[model samples]
Target chain A: MTDPTALSCPAPAAETERVLLGHGSGGRLMAELLRDVIATELGTDPIAEDAAVVDTGTAEVVTSTDSFVVTPRFFPGGDIGSLAVHGTINDLAMRGARPVALTLAYIVEEGLPLDELRAITASAARAAATAGVPIVTGDTKVVQRGAADGVYVTTTGIGVRHPDATPSAAHGRPGDLVLLSGPIALHGTAILSARESLGFESEIASDSRPLHALVAAMLDAGGPDVHTLRDPTRGGLASALNELAETSSIGVDITEDAVPVPPLAAAACELLGLDPLHVANEGCLVAFVAPTAAEAVLHAMHTRPEGAGARVIGSLTDEHPGRVHMRTMLGGVRVVDMLVGEQLPRIC
Target chain B: MTDPTALSCPAPAAETERVLLGHGSGGRLMAELLRDVIATELGTDPIAEDAAVVDTGTAEVVTSTDSFVVTPRFFPGGDIGSLAVHGTINDLAMRGARPVALTLAYIVEEGLPLDELRAITASAARAAATAGVPIVTGDTKVVQRGAADGVYVTTTGIGVRHPDATPSAAHGRPGDLVLLSGPIALHGTAILSARESLGFESEIASDSRPLHALVAAMLDAGGPDVHTLRDPTRGGLASALNELAETSSIGVDITEDAVPVPPLAAAACELLGLDPLHVANEGCLVAFVAPTAAEAVLHAMHTRPEGAGARVIGSLTDEHPGRVHMRTMLGGVRVVDMLVGEQLPRIC
Candidate 1:
C-alpha cells in the first residue's frame, strides 16, 4: 500500500520560488531537463534505448545510480520524476549502450503527501513506458519531515554499449561542424519567469523534454558524422559549446540569425538582463558533425519531431582554437564566453 | 589558465531557511549533506571496484562516472577534491572493479582566487595518488559569479569490476548478520562542530578516510557470503539497517550495548540533540554476512587496520520483516526507523 503522506503533494503556484518535490516529480520537466543540459554535457558515451543490454550473456550486470536534487523540480513543462529516468537512461546511452533495465530508488520526506508521490510514480511509469523502458525494480524510504525536502530519486540504468559507436565527450575534433537540434534558453526562462517573481511573459514555457528518440534518429541518420551529441543545460548554451570547443581545441562560430530563440524568450531575457544564449534549454541538442556530413546530419535532425527546430547554430573554426564566437543580428561579431556560473540554480 | 578569482569563492553566510547551490559544491559538505542522508534513507545500491566489468573479456570494459558537490570544499578531515576521488573509487570498488582512469571536470566561478583552486587541484592529485587512481582527462569552465558557488567537480570513473564475485546491494539475505566497520558519527560530528560559528569540538575528527582498501580486504576474505556491502554514510547506522531490513524482508535487532559510540561523540550528540546513529559518517561500512559466515566476516573486518573497531551491530530475523529493532542499555526495545529529515545541512 502507498503511504498516505507520500501521495499527496501540493502544487505551488507559478513564480513562488516555493518549489515542492513535485517539480522533480519526474513527470515531464525532469526528462526535459535531462534532454536540455546533461545530455549536452555528456556528449556521448554508450547508451541504451529504454533499457541497455549488457550482453555479457551470463554475467550479472553492474549498475551505478544517481539522483537529481535540483530545486524547482517542477517547472514549466516537466518535473523530477521523468528527469530521473531520462538522466539515468542518458547516462547509459553515453556509454554507447542500449539500456536494458533501470532500477528506481526514491527518498521521500515524511509529509510529502502520498498523492504527490503517486503522481510522480505514475509519471515515472508513464515515461518508462513511453521510452519502452521498464523500471523493473525499485525501493522507497521516508525521511523525517525536515530531513528531506520532498523527494529525491536515484536510478541505476544498465545497458550494453554497441560495438559500432565509441562515443564520448572526449572525442570531438577541430574540423567538426556544430549543429543544434533546436533553440536555446527556453527551459531556463520558462521556469524563472513561471515563478511570478520575474513577472515577464512571452508565452515562454520550459523546453524540458525527452530526446532519446532524437538521439536514436541522429545516431541512425548521421552515424559517422555524429561524432558527438550533447544537450545544453545548466550552464546553458555557452557552457556546452565551450566544452566542445575546448575539447576539440577548435574555434566555433555561429550565426545569430540561424539560432532559434522564441520571441517570448528574447523579450524575457532583455527584461531580466539575462543572455538568451546563456539561458538553459531542456529539449535541444548540439552535435559535432563531420564537416563533410554536416548537411546530411542537419537533415536527420530536422526529420525528427523533437528536432524540428534543427539549425546550424555554429561550426568549428581553426583561427581561434578553444574559442567560441557569434555573429550578432546587428551584423557585428561578439565573443561568446563560456558560462561562469549557473543562471538558475536547480532549474533542472 | 585558471581565473584569478578561480578559487576565491566567498559569500557572507546567508540565514535562509531553504537550500542553495552551495550545498552541492564539492568544496566540502555537499556529499555529506545530501548523499549521507540519501544513503541512510535508501541504503546501498550495488558497488563495484576497479572497472565495472562483466566478462566483457578482452574487448569491452565497464566504466562509470559521478560528480561530487559537497559544500565548504574543505572540512575537518578532507575536502571535496579528495571526497570526489574516494567516492568515484568506492563506486568502482563496489563493482569489484579496479579503477584505471578518471576524467575530472570543474566548473569554477569567475574571479575565484587562483590559490584556492590550486589547493583543491593539489588535493585532487593527492587523493588520486593515494587511491592509486589517476586523473587522465579533465575539463574546466568558468561560470559567471553567481552561476556557481566557488567550484564544483564532476569526476567520471572508469573501472573494471571484480571477476570472481559479482556483488550488489540486492544480494542481502534473510539470515545475514550486519557488521559495522568502526565507530560511527565521527565524520558527521567533526564536520558540524568544527564550523567557525559552531565552535564546539571534542577532538571529533571526521572519519572521512577511503574504504576501498577495507572493501578490497573484505572481498579477499569473505567473497559471496558477504551478501551485500555498503558504506553507511550520510544517513548513519540506523538508516542503513532499515534499508537492509526492508530489502531482505528480514528483521534486524541491534543491541545498543553492541553499537560503539565514541565518548566525545556521545557528548556532542547530547549537546546537539542529534542521535549518533542518524548522523553522517564518511568512512564506515555495514557488511551483511550470512549466518554461517558471520563470524568469519567479522574476523576479517577486524583484521584490517581500518576495521579495528569492527563490531557485530545486529542480525537478521524472521519476525518484524523490514523493520529494525534496537535494544537500549536500559533493556528496553525501540524501533530503529529510517532517517527522516536532514540532520546537518552542509555536513560532508
Candidate 2:
C-alpha cells in the first residue's frame, strides 16, 4: 500500500498554485492532485481504483461516476451522450459489476440547438437500451451562453457485483499474467480527428462501447483468478499498467511487439507525434490474471466481439517493484512512465 | 397521467428548433422538454420526483443526481462544493432515504486556481462528514480555459429508504395540508447578491443545508401520512406546488401571507422585481401531509433548527385539478403558474 503519510501530505505550494489542464489529464499530475488535494481533504488514503465497491447489506454493489467534457460533442464513432453512458458503465464493469441502472446529469449551455440535444438524448437512450441498463433519473441545468460549452454530461452507474468476483488492482501478484483486450488509442485519435476536422484516408473511429457482458464472460471463466480489471481510458495503457504496479507493489514486464495497436490508429499517432501506449482507448480493457488461468481467460475474452483481439502482453514480476518496464521490438528495455503532462485534454 | 401520444409527438418544427435557457429553468419549458424530448426517447413516463427509488432485492434504494453550476463558486452562506453535496442529499431525503454514500464528478476549466479547488473540496468533505455520508467515488475532467467556467460539480447520492416511508409527488390526496419547512428564496437572493456584487443593507445568506435529519423527524412523526416532500429549488415554491398538483391531479390552494419568506429575502426579491415564490431556496422543503397528521409533523419539524420556521401554507383540493392558486394578502385568489423563463440562471 502507498504510505498513508505520503498520500496525505500536500504537494509543494509552488507546483500547484493553479490547476492546469494536466491536472485532469488522467496522468501523473491528476494522480498527484487526487492524492495530495482530494484525498487529503477527505482524510482518507486514495483508493485509486476505477470504481468503489460498497456492501449494501444484502449484497455487494459497485458504483462509479464520470463527467464527460469531450471537445466536440460528436466524435467519429460516438457522441458525448453515448460516451457518457459507456464510460460509466465501463467503470462499473472494471469492478466486475453487472450494471443495473444509471443516472444522468447534464450541464448545457444556453441556446444549444434543440435538435442537437434531442439527437444526443436519443443516442443515449439507445445506448442504455442496448446495454440493458436504464437511465432511471436525471437532472439538467443550463448556464449562460459563454459560461459553458455546448454541453457536458455526467453519468453515475449502479451495478451488482459478480458473485464470485473479487478483483482489485492490489491483488496482482508476482507471476500473474497481464492481458490486453483488443487494440488501444482508437478513442483519442478519433476525437482529435473530429475536433481538428482532419479527415484521414482511413477514418479512425472511437471504440466506445459497454463492456459489462465481456467482463461477465471473463469472470464466469476465470473467477477469482482475474486479479484486476481496468479500462485503459483517459491515461491509456501505460497509465493503467503503472497504476496497477503501484497499487499491487509489483513490477510488470511487457513486450511492445505483443501490444495491439490498430494500423490506422498507429499511423495517426505517429503523424500527430503522439505515443500509442499513452493515448486513451474507450472500448478496451486490461486484466491481470493468475498464470494458471491466463489461457482460459484469454480464450473466454477471444469469444467476445469486444475482446476478440485479446492477447497476453505482459507478466507481473518481483524485480523493480512498483514500476512498469516494456521491451522494445529491438529487444531493448525502457521504463513505461505515467504520462507527465496533458497529451490531449478532453479526449474522453 | 399525461397523454402518451402527445408526449411522443415531437414539438412542432416552428415551436422549438433549439434549446433555450428556459428549457433548463425548472419551469414549464423545462418540464415540457423533459416530458416531450427526454422521457419520450426513453420509453418511460417522466418521473418528476427529486429521486427515483429502485428495489435492490433485499432493500429499496433511492438515488439522485444533480449538477451544480452556480455562477460565483463562493456565495453568501456556502460554496458550490457544499451546495453540490447538500443538494443531492436533500433529494435523497425527499424520497425518505437515509443517505449512505455519494459520488462526485467535477468538470473544471483549465487555469482555475488550485487553492480554490482545494477549498471547495474541503468544504464538500466537511459537508459530507457532517451529514454522515461518505463520498465513496469521484472522477474529474478538465476542458480548455475558455471552454468551460471555473468548475461544475455533479453529485450522485445513494441512500436506503426508510422502512415505513413511501413518499411520492403522486401520493398527495385531496384535503392534504401543505407545509413549508423554512423561508423561501434565500438561496436565490444570496447568489444574486454575490454574483452582481450588490450590497444589501443587511447580508442575505443562502439557506444552503442538508435536510435528512429534519426529514427523518417528519417521517418518524407522520409516517405514511406524509404524502410528499420536495425541496423548492430552481423554480421555488410555486413550481414545487404546481408539479405536485399535476402529478396528483389535484388542486393546491396556498395563502401568500402564510408561506414563510425571510424579510431580507423578500426585500431583495422585491428590489430585483422577482417573486419570492418563484425564486429558489436550497435549504427549505415543501411537504404534503394528511390533515390529521399536519400539526404533529409541523411540531416535529419546528423542533429542528432547519425547520424552525415551518408553517402550514396551504391545502389540496379537488377543484381546479392540476393547478395551483394563491390567496393574496389582500384576500383575493390568483392562479400561480410555473415560471415561464429563467429567473436566475446557475443559482445552484
Candidate 3:
C-alpha cells in the first residue's frame, strides 16, 4: 500500500541506516523507507494506492500483492492462510476491482509440520473459493529451520476494474462524506490478545474477512460518486485517513461519537494503551462518497451482511489541507495525527 | 513450477507425517506434497506446468509466482533480487506469455541492513526493466530478527499469451524434438560454490539471466508447432524431461553427448559429486518442437544471445510412455529418473 505521508515528512536521519521493526509498522518510518529507499532505487514514482492498473491491450487489469508473516500462525477467527487470501482480495477491492484470480506463494521453514501446512493451505483455498476467486497458480520454498518462521505466505491478486467506479486515495474532495463499514480495532486487538496470552482472547476475535462484496454494493449504488475506498490494515484508520488527506490535499473532520468501535475491542485498546483509531481492521472499509450519493451508498451497504454497521463518521473539508480533525465528546476539536512509529508490528 | 511426476508415483506413506527439506526440492517428494496435500485439499487438479492461463473475458492472462530464499543472499552471477525477477519471468515465458507487469514482495528480517535492501531493490528493478516488464505493485513486511533470514522475495508476473502459440506440457506428441537453450548446472553449481566456499566461485557463475527473449524467438519461428516450453530450474534437465514425458504420457529418448555442458560447470559437478543434468538452471529453456519445425526453431534460437549454445538433445517417443532413456557416450542406455530428494536446497 502507498504511504502519502512520505510527501509531507522530513527526510529520515542518515545514521538510522538499518531497517527497524518500525519500517514495517505502517507508520511514518515505513512510508519514509518506501519513499526514500524502495521507490528511489526502483526509479518509479511512489505507488499511491493499494493496487495498480495495467493496460492489457484488450482490458485494464488490476494487480496487488501482500506477504503475511503474522506470528503464532493460527490465530482465533483466522490464520495466515485465510489472511493471505483476504488481505490481497481487500487490496483489489479498495481499487474498485473484482478479483478474478490469485497466486499463492509460501516460504516454509524446513521443519514445519505437514499437518500445519495442510491446514493453512486448506484455509487459504476455502477462503478463495468462498470469495469466488481461484488460487490458479502457486509456489512453495523451504528454508532451513532457523532461517524462517514456521511459514510466510505471499498472495498476488489479479482483477478487472469495476466499470462504474474509479475510487482512489487521491480522489477525495471537500464535501465528500466518509462512511465506515462495521467497526474498528477488532483485528489488531484479537492478534495482540492471542500473541501475549492476554485474558481478553474470548472477548475479542479478528474481523479478518473479505470486504469485496460490500465494496461492490457501494459501487453499484453510488457509481462514480464513490470517490475513495480504503481498508484500515497495518497502520489502521488513523494512518489511512492521514494518507488520504495528504494524497488528496483535503482536510477531514470527524464526529468521534459516530465512529463505531466494538465494545470488546474498545476495552482491549484502552487496557493495552493502544488507540482504537490506530488499530488494524481486516473486514471493514472507509469510503469517501459524494455527499449527494451518501445516503444511497449507506443504504446499499446496509443490505450486505459485512456492511450492516455502516455509518457516516466524517466529511472532507478545505479548512486544513492535508490534515484530519475529530470533534471530541467534550465539544473540542483535536488533530488526529498519524502514528509516528509502530505501535504493533505484524498485526496483519 | 509444477511437477508431473505426481501422476506416476505411488501413494506416499502416512508414516511420513512431517514436512522434509525434500518437499520443496523440486523432486518426487515435492510433487507428492503438491498433489496429495495442497492440490487435494484445495479441490483442484494438480498443476503440471510453469504458469496458469486465466481467461479474462477479453484476453488470456498468464500468472505465476515464486519466492527466492537462496543462502548468502548474493552469489556468483546473480543475487536473490535478480533471481526473483528472472525466475518469475522465465515461468511466464515457458507458457508462451509475453510478460506485461510484475509484482515484488519482501519479507524482511528486522535489523537487516538498509544498504542491503537498497542494493537488492535496485537489482530487481534493473532486471525488470531489462525484461521490459514494470514492477507495477508490491508489498513489504518485517519480522523479528530470528524469525527470518536477512530477506526473502516473492515475485509474481502477469503476461499476455502469444497470439500465435499455444505451448503446454501436455501438448507434446510422439515425434516432437527436445532442444536445450544452453548449458545446465551453472546456476546450481555457482550457488553451491558460493554457499559452501567450495573454491569454484571464480570458475563457475550462475546462468541467471531472463530467457523470455529467446523464447519469443522460438515461438516466432515455430508458432503453434512449438509443442512445449520449460525452463529447467529447480530440478534441472532430468526432472523437466521426466515431467514432460509423464504429463504428455509419452517417452523421451536422449543422447548424452548431445546435451551441452560448459567445461567449467562439468568440472565443478564432477568435483562435487553431482550430475550436471540434475542441477538447476535459470536462464535456459527446454523447447519441445515438432520435427518438421525443429530446424527453423533451432536456427531462430541461435540468433538470440541466450540461445547461442542451444542444441537438439532428445526426442519424444511412444515405446515406453512416461519414461526417459539416455544413450550414454559409451553407447550404453540407462533410465534417467527424477531426483528422489534434494540435490541442492534453495538453489533458485
Candidate number of the best DockQ = 3
State the lDDT at B82 in candidate 3. Answer: 90
Off by over 4 Å in 2: A1-58, B1-58
Q: Report the interface RMSD that candidate 3 achieves against the true structure, in angstroms.
A: 15.6
Looking at model 2, give its docking quality level.
Answer: incorrect
RMSD (CA, Å), each prediction: 11.4, 18.4, 17.6
| Top lDDT prediction, candidate number | 3
Order candidates by DockQ, high to low: 3, 2, 1
Q: Supply the DockQ value of model 1.
A: 0.09
lDDT of 2: 0.79
Give, for candidate 1 chain B, the lowest lDDT window spanning 10 residues.
B42-51
lDDT of 1 by residue, A1-348 (tens): 988987888765564222233223222222332233233222322121111112333333323344555456565566778777776565455434456666555545555654566566666766677777655544343334454556666565555545455445555776777788887878778877876557653367777666667766666766655777666765677766766666667788888888888787888888878887678766777877788877876777788887888877767778788778999989999888755433455555
lDDT of 2 by residue, B1-348 (tens): 888987786866653243332332222343454456434432345432211223344444677888998878998899999999999999889888878878777777766765566677778878988998877777667677677788899999888776787788788899999999988889989988877767852399999999999999999999999989989787678877877787788999999999877788888888899888878888999999999999999999999999999999999999999899999999999999875455677788
Which prediction has more favorable DockQ, 1 or 3? 3
On lDDT, who's better, 2 or 3? 3
True contacts kept of each: 0.03, 0.30, 0.31
Candidates' lDDT values, in order? 0.62, 0.79, 0.79
Tens-digit lDDT string for candidate 2 (A99-180): 8878777787766765566667767877888998877777667677777788889999887778887787678999999999
